[model samples]
Target: MDLNSSSPQTIPVVSTFSSPFDQSPPVKDPNSASTRKPISLWPGMYHSPVTTALWEARSKIFEGLLDPPKDAPPQSELLTKTPSQSRTTILYNFSSDYILREQYRDPWNEVRIGKLLEDLDALAGTISVKHCSDDDSTTRPLLLVTASVDKIVLKKPISVDIDLKIVGAVIWVGRSSIEIQLDVIQPAKEESDDSEPVALTANFIFVARDSKTGKAAPVNRLSPETELEKFLFEEAEGRSNLRKRKRVGDRKEFENGEVNQLEALLAEGRIFCDMPALADRDSILLKDTCLENSLICQPQQRNIHGRIFGGFLMHRAFELAFSTAYTFAGLVPCFLEVDHVDFLRPVDVGDFLRFKSCVLYTELENPDQPLINVEVAAHVTRPEIRSSEVSNTFYFTFTLRPEAKATRNGFKIRKVVPATEEEARRILDRMDADA
Candidate 1:
């Protein structure tokens, strides 16, 4: 069971690993020399021609998302164009490079939410390849990815030679998705601090593909021009119609007396915030509030189409849900949003994964912020029959740092209970179907 164990914990050998819902007989790892290959949908977005001539030598940093019409655009709207000749805003900045600030320093140099989700997944794949090459800046080059990330708050703690910036734009476009919006600012570290907040914001989505049939293609269309880009194009068209009503079943599934109405609202103490009468039910038991990690899926953590890289499994489930919400809220949480992640399968290259995390609920929202949701999951092992598999499932959200008598008034944390009653009606049907 030594699938190249790099140790972050690792223990599941469960007999000899192999069942993420069986592909029937495929677990032989005589110390795997990496050959289980078959699921690598080539997303090598560009493995050099000097990285496609340094992306056509940054065609003017994608002329603000392709304003390319100095003539030629007519073979029947050549893959549809408009949105004022393709939306805009892209800005970047980044500074602190010395092998990226010594690989995210730790003897105190800051910058590590797993190197800020691998630099916000390479700045949301360079704003989805400059908004899918501003709708074909002369064709052939799509292969985008990261098809889901709708949230990523972070709001502070970047340090290490500061700079950053980022920005991005494309609000929502669909017909092969796009979304974008990200933010990530930095600046004001004090020129007598004239405000510049927003240490991160995120909303990504990206899809495009088809660089020789990986499929889904077409893009370009977010027109909105101010009034805050039409209120972020109507909040990215209501989160792209709530991600097409949770992808087509038009949403609605939490029944079975939704955890008997969350155990009659936690046996009548009617929880909805202000809790601390030493919040009970054996102190929020989901197996006594969890947090795990394990490891062994390296190869420099795969990706560029080799799997296991959704921002390095979202930086190992946001550093184990910020170490189980900093050991159940003794403070230091921050990073809010990533309210969903569903990769669901693909973590191979010597699998062993694991992750786990917990605390599935907590809120206060104001009264000195408090939120915390977490969840995590992942799994993989399979050791013959000791079983494992699940693969992925994230759902983050945090917020704590308030200080002054520890967050002024609301947060004696510790609340996620669900340990059956169908995991308490699937955590009250996923927090009432995700709020």
Candidate 2:
């Protein structure tokens, strides 16, 4: 069946009621399948049986890593796969009777969106591996790593009491890159005629690399059968093009010393520096709102390929961004959307990782719900060499809690002002991207 057919395809939903870590003790018989322990899935609100099976099947990649084969098949021998072939669904039963609701509920009785982001990354990885896997499992598996997250938009607030499901599949594929699209949906209640509403949509891009050589590896071509599938493929292609154009434009702008609206902002910044007392009392300097955290990556946080997991980085970055927004807004901050995330370099297990976050800007167009943009840059520090390199950059948007405006009298967020030329340039760059 076509994944994007007009009629909804029947997806095999795997419930998250049983904990993957709660399996029974291994049997005495060596030949019995129960004697073998199942590959443990990451602890989370949702888990797909299909993904688990895939992981178990590909577990031999670890052995191959130690002793790699001499010859490998060429890219031309790979099979062409359809979107439906890699489609998967994971169900989160958060109804009134289910015990799983407590795990996902926040203090405000709403679903925790940060945890969901982590799971989305995991699910996207599963889809990518499923699309790139071949029939011959004896050979080594490709090392699929997350290249970037194009965008994740929140369409509606997710309630903790409703049943939810996440469906995802490969929407487009290139020479060595694959784009996966995921939809988080709230299923309709029993006896209701309403349709399932999508609460969030996410697009993730993954790149395949040879396990032994650590070079680019080819992936199966995606064949879109239905009109919807074709349209999505084309849309992803256009987004890829836009990203390339943006990079080129940014380089040219910097080379030509073009600062369109930044000149005025620079002048304003200089004036603020010259006369500190004349600045607006209701505003705060962007530099003063920074928060930083540092830690050494551990083996427990590594992914299947023995590298730091991308989801772990995202989870930590998001927590810091939330804290930055909360401090800047002086109230509880709610996650609005993840604008974009770029994985520039892979972080190692023992790398000293530092996460620095600050409030980049704020939008007060809506007085009741002020929007705040937070940026987090992850850097790997090497004290021996006295050098540091950025491994990832994350951009997140947040807002104040809805009740904050009603509870606090004359409540307003202080405007964030840039005091340095670099800060001014950052603000202008964000504005141009939004435009």
Q: After superposition, how far is residue 392 of candidate 2 from its true place, in Å?
A: 0.9
For residues 308-329, write the lDDT of model 2, one tens digit per residue.
Answer: 8787889899989999998887
Off by over 4 Å in 2: 1-37, 41-76, 96-99, 188-194, 254-260
Tell me the deviation in Å of residue 306 in model 2.
Answer: 0.9
Prediction RMSDs, each to the true structure? 23.0, 4.6
lDDT of every model, 2 decimals: 0.58, 0.76
Question: How do the predictions measure up, each by TM-score?
Answer: 0.34, 0.86
- Root-mean-square deviation of Cα positions for candidate 2 versus the true structure, in angstroms: 4.6
